[model samples]
Every structure is written in C-alpha cells, then in structure tokens.
Target chain A: MIGMTLILKKINQLIVGLIFLYGIYIITHGHLTPGGCFAVGAVIAGAFFLLVLAYGSDILKLRKREEGSSVAESTGIFIFLVLAFTALIIVTRIFFTNYLPKGITGELISSGVIPLYNIAVGIEVAAALFNTFLALYL
Target chain B: MELLLSIILGLMILGAIYALFARDLMSALISCGIVGYGLVICFLLLQAPDLAIVQIVVETITLLIMIAVVLDSSREELKEKKAAEVKLSHFRKWYVMNVILIIVCLVVLLYFFKEVTSTLDPLGKHLTRMSTAYIEYAAEKTGSANLVTGVLFDFRGYDTLGEATILFTAVIGVLTILRVKGKK
Candidate 1:
C-alpha cells in the first residue's frame, strides 16, 4: 500500500508539471493562436480536477482551498486595477489609458500590457475554476 | 432557405417544449443550456463574436451555479406542505396567461431580430478591407498580431478595466454568498 501511494504521488507530480507547462504555453501563444487565458486556465483546472478525482478530497485538503481561492481572487482583481490605474495616472494622463509602449508584433515577449493582462486573467481563471471544483468536491 | 429556417424554428419550439416539460430539474437545466447554445449560434450568425463569447461565458457560469444549487437543494428532504387546490377555470386561465406571455415574447424577439439584421453594420466589409493593416499598424504602434488584445488591453484599456470591475463584482458576490461563519 505504501509503495502504491508513492507511485501515485510520483504520477501526480508528473501530471501537475505537464499541466503547468501547457498552461504557460497557452498563455504565451495566446496572441498567435485561438487559445488564450481562459482556455488555458480551464485546461489547468481540468488537470487539478483529475488529480483530485484520483487522490480524493483528502489530497486537496493540503491546499485549504477557501483561503487560497480568496487570496487569488482578490489579488487578481488588485493586479487588474493597479495596471489600469497606473496607465491612466502616468502615460495618457487619462484614467485607464493604454500608456505602455507597443514593443513589437509577433514576438514572444511582445504586447506589453496584453501579455500582462493575459497572465492576470490566466491566474484569475485557474484559481476561480479550481475554487469552484474544490467547493463542489468538498 | 425556407427549409433551413423551418428546421431551426422547429428545433427551437421543440427545445422549449422539452424545457417546459422535463421531469427532472437537471434535465430542465440542460434544456435551458440548449436554448442558450441556440442563442449563441444566432449571435454568431449575426456576426457578433464578442457578444457570443460573453453570452457563452455567462451561460457556462450560470449553468455551473444552477447545477450546484440543484445538487445542494436536492440533498435536503423537505416536508410536503398542503397544497391549495385550484378550480378548473382558474387553472385554464393561468395556462392561458403563460401561453400568451410566451407568444408575446417570441413575437417581440422575432421583430427585434428582423430589425437588427435589416440594419446590419458593414463590419465584415470593414474587417476584410482594414483588419490586416490595422493589425500591422497596431502591432507597430502598440507592439501587439493580437490586434484584438492590443485594442482590448491598451488602446481601449478602460473597457478592459470595466470588464475587470465586473468580474470583481462577481467575485465579491460569490464570496458574500458562500462565506459561512464558524466553518473554518
């Protein structure tokens, strides 16, 4: 039984790593492809769901979902607001203006605010979906 | 053309009937989802991807909540309260009222669809002519092939802020609803 548990833990770790990489890929390639923050988050949440399904609610007990989810939800909102307000107060001198420099098109590191926004949304969605699943499972 | 419209109309009517008569609440909810999917198709056909996406997201969230609520509610067994018996004439009147309301709503929707399609925006023409150049110029200026992203996040950043706030409001509402005291 102990050996089987160890094997399951190793498999779970591998699955989690693969899912994380896929999430980043989707977020980065969001500009060029049909996939974006929401799709990627949904995918990542799906992986988490699979893990929970395999390991049961006992495994997710380690995460303490309510606290983690609230923090994620609040922080995502803060990040979104701060980005918008900073752009407004500084660059265009107008509230919520896109003051960030448009760097270059089609580059992986391009689209300054776009990528940042995507990241924020990706975090928000992943957290929200996970929270929903946790809430339901619990 | 007529055949397509007839088939669509028939499907919609059948869906409504199913939604109305489904024995289980979950089945009714799924029928409601079907109705929403139908609306999404209509939105896409009307050339409004933004609206369609928004509608789809909202429907997904609503369906999730509905399923959760149904699950929670079904877990409880409530005592059956005595029911007030209705007269035949009263039942007939109530049924008539509901059918009239449904017919009125359908007619209103049909009229709205006709009006909107008749005044369709020349967006497809505009997109074909200018979208590539717009993307190029926007990318050069704003540094984003994700022209939509550039427009959403930078050019019209305020709109994105509005969207963020809307999401934030939803989050707050969810927390408020879900937060239970002494639960840990």
Candidate 2:
C-alpha cells in the first residue's frame, strides 16, 4: 500500500478532492436526484479508501482520526434523531413528519428537512464505514 | 435493454456458480464482487438508478471487507486446507445430493416463471393501487422531485429510521467485537 507508484500517487492525490466533492454533491442533491445519503456516503468512503491505498494507512493519520470518526458517527445519528424528534414536537406532532413548506420543485433548498436528514445520514454512513475500515486495518 | 439485462443476469449467475466452486478464498471473493457488479447493472437496466448507486457502493465496501478478512486469516486458511480436503471426500455424497436438489429447484423455478409470465399482461395494464397513488401524489405530498427519495424519506420515514437504527447497531456490534483489550 506504500504508494503504488509515483504517477499513481500523484493521480490519486489529484482525484481525491473531486471524489469528495462529487459525494457532497450527491448528498446535497438527494431530494432532487437518484443519489442519496447512503450512496454519497459510500462514494466519500471510497475516496478515503483510495487515500489509504495510495498513501498507506500510517500516512492517513488513521490512529489519530479513528476517535474523531467514531465521534462523528455518533454525532451524525444524534443530529438525525434530534431532527426527527423536533419534527414530532414542532411540526406535525408525529415522528419523521415532513412539515416545512414544499418549495418549488427542482430547487436546491426546496425539500424542507429532507436535505438536512440526507446530510446527517451521509455523515453517519461515511464515518461509520471509514471507522470500520480503520478498525479492520488496525 | 432487455438483451443487455439478460446478459448481465446470465453473467451474475455464472459468477455465483464460480464463487460457489472456487477452491481459493481470494478468487471466490473476487467472483462475488463480479456478481455484485452484475446485479448493479441489472438494477440500472430496470430503471432503478437509486438502487444501482447504493448497490455499487455497498459492493465495493463488501469487497474491501472481504479482502481485509482474507489477508488477516491467510495463514489460517492455508492450514485448514488439508483438513478441508480430507472432509471433502466424506462430504461428496452430500455435495452430489445438494447439486441434484439445486437443479431440481432451478427447473421448478423456471416452470413457475413461464407460468407467471404467460398469465401476466404484457402491457403492464394492472398497476398496484399503492404504487399508482405514489406516482400520482409523491411530488405533491413530499415536495421532492425524485419520487423515490420522497417516498423513502417522507412517506416511509419510519422505515428509514428503522433502517438507520439497524445500521447503527451493526456498526456498534462490529466495534464491540473488534475492540482491543485495554485500548480505548
């Protein structure tokens, strides 16, 4: 795993950023597109996996970041639950209710709490998967 | 599109058979990956892009996990091979029985498939009420343009919540099992 080759390493470095960006794009556009939180999260985790393969586990700072990923995973789920509960409390008084105004279709900010939920789930999935990889690698 | 789907499905069946009979663990894992990707292609051809996206990602992660397990237990696997070979001879009768059972099952399934297809309307004239309702009202009810997302996150939010909880529990279980003693 210690840098497949100089050219491969360089290419991986260049493409990792784009991969992450694409993952984020998919997550954010979940309400409007075919891709959703889980798909985007996996894509982001793929980027991390690629990073690990290119640079080796030691250089990825996996040891130090392992705790961070665990915390992020928990926090993401916590945020999702809180959002669901808030919807219960403030909006429809029913759990998981989509209460916000359904803005015009095809807009970025149209889906009320769906986008937020997607982002939360995306974070949870990405962190959980990356953490699992780190655990297995260790 | 139908031809492409049939090809992919045939390849998936081939991959599954190869994985089942592969002598080495690594090749079996690789063949499993091939089957998983073929399923993803089949999903895409069925016009389920969301399923395809999710399946492809899951397949990749599964491959990585299998590779890690294989690497970790390489020596153990090698050690077990001799014992496995000894047991294989003893299990030959059962293997043959299982193969015959599988062929019988496949033939029965093919017969049922033909029966069902011949009875069904070719034009899909009979849509289920729930699906028709969803198609008609999903955008209006959830305000999401993507009907699948709207249904998953809005109409079926409880189900999604349950799915999330299940995933969380699985991760927690994995972490608990793999946790090193005396290490935080």
lDDT of every predicted structure (CA atoms) = 0.67, 0.84
lDDT of 1 by residue, B1-184 (tens): 4465456667767887897767688888888888777777766676655456556655675676677678657733343444324455567779978899999999999999999878776534553645666655776666767566667666666676676567656756665555444236
lDDT of 2 by residue, B28-123 (tens): 899999899998888877788999999998898889878867876772334577789889887885998889999999999999999998988764
Off by over 4 Å in 2: A1-8, A64-66, B23-26, B68-126, B182-184
Weakest lDDT window of 10 consecutive positions for candidate 2 chain B: B71-80
Give the per-residue Cα lDDT of candidate 1 at A104: 61
Q: After superposition, how far is residue A16 of candidate 1 from its true place, in Å?
A: 6.9
Candidate closest to the true structure, highest TM-score? 2
Candidate 2 DockQ vs. native: 0.71
Per-residue lDDT of candidate 1, residues A1-138 (tens digit) = 011266776788788778778778877876654455666666666667657655666654534535676578678767877777786677767766546565566778766667777778777777777765555446
Candidate 2, RMSD to the unseen true structure: 3.3
Most lDDT-accurate candidate: 2
